[model samples]
Structure formats: C-alpha cells, structure tokens
Target chain A: MKGIIYGLVFFVSLFCSSFAVAIASKPIVVASTTQIADFARQVAGDRLIVKCVLAPGADPHTYQPTPDDVQMVLESDICLENGLHLEGKNWMSTLATDAGKPIITTTDGIKPLAISSEGEMVADPHAWFSPKNVAVYVNNIVKGFSQLDPDGKQNYEARATLFLQQLRVLDSWVRQQINRIPTQRRILVTTHDAFNYFCTEFKLNANNNFLSIAPVGWSTGAEVGGGMTPERRRKVVQSIKESGAPALFVETTINPKQIREIAKETGVKIGGELYSDSMGPEGSAGETYIGMMRENVLLMVNALK
Target chain B: MRFLLVVTIWVVIVGGLWGYIADRDTRRQQITAATPMDLSVEGRFVIEVTPTFSTEKDPFALTTSDSSVPPLTVKLNGMYIDTHTQEVLRGQTLRYEDVSGVLSGHNEIYVSASPPLSENTLEHGVRVKLYEDSTLVVDQTVWADQGALVSGTISFNHSADEEGSHDH
Candidate 1:
C-alpha cells in the first residue's frame, strides 16, 4: 500500500509540472467584463489564455471582484477593461489597481458621449455595444497586446484584421436594417448609458439618462443610480413625447418595470430588450460580442422600423 | 481524484460550447490587406487649399519680394463633382484666386454643387490646390479598403521648406 501511494504521488508531480509549463508558455489576458474579454479573446487567438473576471450571467455594472478574480488579475500580464466608467467606478478601478498589471481601456481614443444635457460632455464608455465602436476597441486591443508580446504581434494583427472586417460588415448590415425604420421613429430608449456608441454608430438618438452599462440610481436602492427622481422620469417622458419617438427600448441587464411604466404612460410600445451589459450565457444568440450586437440591431429594426 | 477534477475543468474550458469558442480561436485569418488611409494619428492636409499658381495677378495684388514674380495667383475651380463621374458644375463651381499654401488655415472649403449632399456617403471628399503654384492634389479619389483603412502618401506641394520654390 505504501509503495502504490508513492507511485501515485510521483506520477501526479510529473503531470503537474508539465501542465504548469504549458500554461506559463501562453500570454495571459484578464478582462474586466465579459464583453471586453470576449473581444480580447477574439483578437488574442491561441497565443492568449483569456480569463474573464465577470462570470457568465454576471452583471458587470454590479460586479465586485472576488479574491479569485484578484488572483487572476495578479497572475495576468495584461488586463483589458471597458473604461468610460462602465464597470461601476470604484469597484473595477480597485481591481485594476490591485492587480498591478498594465491595463488597456478599450475605449481610449474614441470620442465619447457625455451624459450631461449639453450633448458634448463626459466620456460614455459602453462603446463596445456598437459594432463600429468595437472596431476602434479592436485596434486599441491589438496595439496593447503587441506592446506586451511583440513576438505575437503578427498573430494579433491577423486576428484583429479578420474581426474588424466582420465589424464593418456588421455595421453596414445594421445601417441597412435601420434604414427600414423612418427617420422620425429612430429614437432609442434603454436602461443605462450603454447604447451611446450604438446610437452614434447606427445614427439613432439614444436616451439613456442612466447612461451606463452599469445601472446607477440617483441614490442607493433606486432602480438605477437611485435616479428614479420625479424630474428624471419627466425628462424621459418629455423626450419621448418631444421626439415623437413612437417606441422605447430596454436592456437585458436592467429590470423592465422602469421601462414598462414609462412605456405605458408615454403611450409608446416597448420595442424589445437589448443585450447591453453582458452577452448571453452560452447557447443564446448574444453569446459573442458580434452575435450580441447583431441580435440587438435585429431586434431594434423589428421594433422600431 | 484531484487530477480528474482538474481534467474535467480543462474539458469544460476546451469542450462543450466553450469548445466552439476555442475552435474559433484557431480559425484562420481571412481579412484582405487594406491600403492604409491617407489619414494618420497626426497627418497634415490643406483643409482650405489654395487655388493655383499663375502669372496673372489681381489689380490690387501687392508686390512683396520680387515684383516680376509672375504675380503668383491661384485660380482654383473647385466643385464637388459626382464621385463616380468627374463632371464640373456650371453654377455650383467654386472659384478661389492666387492663394498660397502657407496662408492656408483649417476651414471647410465647400463647393455648391448642383446636387447638395443632404445624406451620408461611405466616401466624402474635399479637393484642394495651391492657386499661385498651380499645384493640385485630388482627394475624392481616395477610398477606404476592406477595413475602412485609407493609405498612400498625401503630397502637399508646399512643405515648410518647399515654400517659395516650385518642385522645379
């Protein structure tokens, strides 16, 4: 019995070392949210060992990284996060700081939408929701990875090129679908500020006062940002009336009640819920970023146009 | 027993729906190489280009360095022509005279074409010229490749050093 146990231990030790060698050889990419992770993996290819901090079905807006998540970041050489305040401010930033890894905010050079009324204000970071915006994200990610692993630059660029083409095609297809809807009906209303990029890309006027993939309540315990103030609700109601927006939109991450009440009061029908914060679990259509955007656009066209 | 647990995770990560995703990681790149766009992070374009070089000077043409200097004037006939067919407009043609590339500042040089662009196009163009130098660079000819990337050297006749002297 003692001899058999020793043999088992020896074989396990040998297997563990071999596995460690294989894992260490690949570059590590730790992403803040599931969407960014999906985008990174699309570009990083086999050369990367991608790990998403937000679990499947986890809402990034409300995500608090666990010790395991911190460890994942600490072990990774690179981190990719959706900036624009999409990860609920302090929570995501703390993880980025603690991990002490070089982090790239995918929305870095793109012009951002400010939630402030002036129309030209703070950077809206949920740019990945728009396929065209994702094109920009793709470039930034490729540049960051190349900086980290010059040896895999060719692989990254090649992957980016292919993915970006799909984005361009997706953008064109979205435009075609949106064209089905008349200009007056192009108003898009969603739960958070998540769709700014989508609105900009597809040329729809998106009203997301909550204005973030991560919902904010004007106060704590509010549906979003505690922002369900009488004034904010009025603004949405007024915007819908003023824009003659025959329709309103919802997001997957947010509860539909806030939107339901507004839709009922405003006398507008709910178009459809969109995939905003996170993609679908696994088998659903919105599993991949591209797939998510495609599903959202298709739903939008069906609802509005 | 521990080995089996880890093996199952590896199986989950490398198999099932994730397997489809993992397979995508190995898919070959299929994007066609695009010519880089004429624009770069920091690139220069004569926003409001000069007209062209010419000996004919306006009546009020001020004489500076050398009066005999062909009264350098640029007579540019810039019209936003049909992108598909390059045809000048009779009324919509814009005319700028004896402009130097140096005095060129950033401005939207608009040409009132017969048909105003009320909608968007994948390709939008701005044509420019150095009037006094008779130097012209056509921009509408540019196109975005598969990745919407534009490429090629944007030649401006008047580099900071090439100011007074024509390429000649």
Candidate 2:
C-alpha cells in the first residue's frame, strides 16, 4: 500500500514539474502600446506572452505608468516601445531600464518625419500610419523576439514574412485606392499632425509642402487647449481654403470637438474618424495594424474621391 | 518496519525531486540548442551630387528647380532610411550598422535626392555596400539623377549550411 502511495506521489510531482517548465518556457513580452502588442502577437504567435501597457484607445502621450507596470516590466523578458518620444514622459523606457529588461524600439529603423512645434523640431512617432513603416515595425519585432527566444527564430521569421506579404499587397492596394482621387484633391486634413508619413507615402502631399495641416502639432503634450495655436489654426484654415479640401478627419485617441469646429469653420464635413494614435478596440474593423490602415484608406478614398 | 517505511518514503521523494530537476535541465538544454542566433544586416550608403547648370533659358522657371541646394535622402524598402539635410559640397557617406529590419531573404534599398535629382546634375550618383558577418556581400552604384531613384536588393541565405552552403 505504501509503495502505491509513493508511486502516485512520484507521478503527481512529475506532472506538476512538467507543467511548471512548460509555463516558464514561453518568454514574456511587454509592449508599451496596444499597437505594438498587436505587432508582437503577430510575430510571436504562441511563442511569447504579449502584454500591452496602454489599453486600446488610451492616450499614450499622457499615460502614466502605474506600480503594476513596474512589476510587469520586472517579469518581462523583453519590452517593446514605439520610441521617438511617443511615450509622453518616457515612462516605458524608465520602467524597462529600472528592471534591467531588454527594450526594443519598434521605430528604430524608420525615417521619422520632423515637425516644427513651438520653435522646436520634433520627430513624429506615428510611423505606423504608413504601411511601409509598419513593415519596419514588424521586422523589428521579429528581431526582438528572435533575440529573446533564439529557438523561435524560424517561427518568428516565418510569421513576419507572411505578414510582410500582406503589407505589400496592402501597399499596392492603398496606392490604387489613392490614385482614384485626382491629384489636385488628394488633400488629407486631420485633427493632429499624425498623417505626414501616410500622406508622403501616398503622394497626397504632391506640392512638397510639409504641412499636414492640423490644429494640433506633432504631440498632444502641449498645454490643454493650447496645442492649437493661432498660427497653426490659420495655417490649417489657409491650407483647407487653398486646397479646396472636401472633408476633414478626427482621430480615435483625440476629442472630435476640435476637428468638428474646424470642419464647421472650413465648411467641409467631417469625413470620418481615423485610427491615429491608437488602433480600434478588439473585434472592431480597425483592430489590427493592417485593418486600421485599410479602414483609414477606405474612409479617405470614399470621402475624398 | 517503521524505519523501513520512513526510508522508502524518503527515497521516493528524492527520486521524484531528482527526476523533476533532470527533466527541467534536459528541456532547457533542448531549448538552448534549438534557439537560433539573431541575424542583422549592416551597410554603408554614399551619395555624390554635382551641381549642374540647366539647359533651360530660365533655370528658376522650372518647377523642379530650387534656389537652394536640396538635401539628399534615402529610403530602404519604401521607408526613409536617412535624410541628410546638411549640404554636401563634394559628397557624403553614411554608415548603417546592425540595421534590425533586414530579413533572411531579399532586402531592398532605395536612394533619392530632394528637389528631385535633375537631369542637368552632373556626376550625381549613389553607392551602396552591404555586409554580412563583417564580410562584403554587395558593392554597387547607380546614377541618382538618371532615374531620380537608385535601388538594389541584397539577399541573405542564413540557412545555407543546413541546405548546402551557398552565398548570395
């Protein structure tokens, strides 16, 4: 009877140990934003556990990291952030650095658009606006995952390749859609200056004017209600009038009130909201990176064309 | 009999613990062996643009004409790789190391000049050098003004040894 008891104990211990090892084997990936988390998931698949610091639709520019964020970083094997000062006060970097965790900047390789704000030139952190830049983000994510879990290199690379193919198709499709709109009417006005890369990629800025004509500058960190200066407002208004823009757009992560006012002032209807700073909530059409880009383009073409 | 029972229980526990630890270590070793080292691409980009007078009667009338010298910018795989706004009278060389977005297969690099590389610009061109593991893999140059776009692809076959050693 004692022998049987010992045998059962041994089997249970073995099972429990195996379970622990299985659970611990998968690396933990902590991403600073929901968009970064989505990219990580695409590359990591089941190889890593991806956690996002900012929830969907959360304003990253003003987000403050909680104590739990610190703990999460401590347990994370890798942390990914959409660098270029997108994390407001650099909370993500601070957390990762404090925990000695490896941090990967998803925007590391992409050329950032520079915007002049309040007499300072700042790099726009919204590179994900362009599908081409998202490809860069995907590549960086794959590299980061492979480094963290070298055993999963092939897996990461495979997923990245598949996703990149989709992006290439998406890029061509975006071009086709944008081309439907006449060159003269290809103006895209939004609430903030987040669409520079998108416009540049699609050739919407045909005149080479650096104005993505928005009430807000490159960042929302400016004082409340102070982001839209008289100069910016006048420029946006002038651009809208000169370009004969048909419609305007707001963003998911910002208040629609400002854009609505602009629309009212310009006599151009609010075309629709675009997923800018953050992607849409889960189960929505704009949830994934590709979906968000597609939806934004569809809205633009439908409205502008 | 009690002592015997105690010894048996202790032996069972020890065996169980030992088996658990050994299993974990084996799994770890398997993972370590299976893990593949990360691969990255590094290279240098050089651009040389020579000012040229336009054949047009009025150079300022050309829409592409700029009074000030335009900056040289480059894009890799449709994304901006670098933008040198500072004037380069003779030429400029830019080095990129451990660029993370490089794939195991084909990669594209594009070079362009702002204010548009005009036809009149003489001796304006771009040179690209790609390296893998510190070994030169690609050395090519294309005239920038001829196309206003100089592009190339560098292919990396990382699993060459496993498939049969090959260089690209």
**DockQ leader:** 1
Query: What are the per-residue Cα lDDT tens digits for candidate 1 across A92-162?
Result: 66776886778888888767776652345666666776665676677788888888999888888777766
The parts of candidate 1 lying over 4 Å away from their true place are: A1-17, A56-62, A117-120, A206-222, A225-239, B1-168
After superposing candidate 2 on the true structure, give the runs of residues whose Cα lies further than 4 Å from its correct spot.
A1-17, A207-211, A216-219, A223-243, B1-168
What is the per-residue lDDT of model 2 for residues A1-305, given as tens digits with 9 covering 90 to 100?
76557666766787899999998877899999988898889888987989998888888888989998999999999999999999998889999999999999999978899987678999988888777688778878887787778888888878876676566556666777787898888888777778888887778856647346564332355542347777877766666666567788788887777657767887888889899888899999988988998899999999999
Q: On a 0 to 100 scale, what is the lDDT of residue A19 in model 1?
A: 94
| Error of model 1, residue A20, in angstroms | 4.7
- Fnat of candidate 1 is 0.04
When summed lDDT is taken over every stretch of 10 residues in candidate 2 chain A, the lowest stretch is A216-225
Error of 2 at A145 (Å): 2.1
For every model shown, what is its TM-score relative to the native structure? 0.58, 0.61
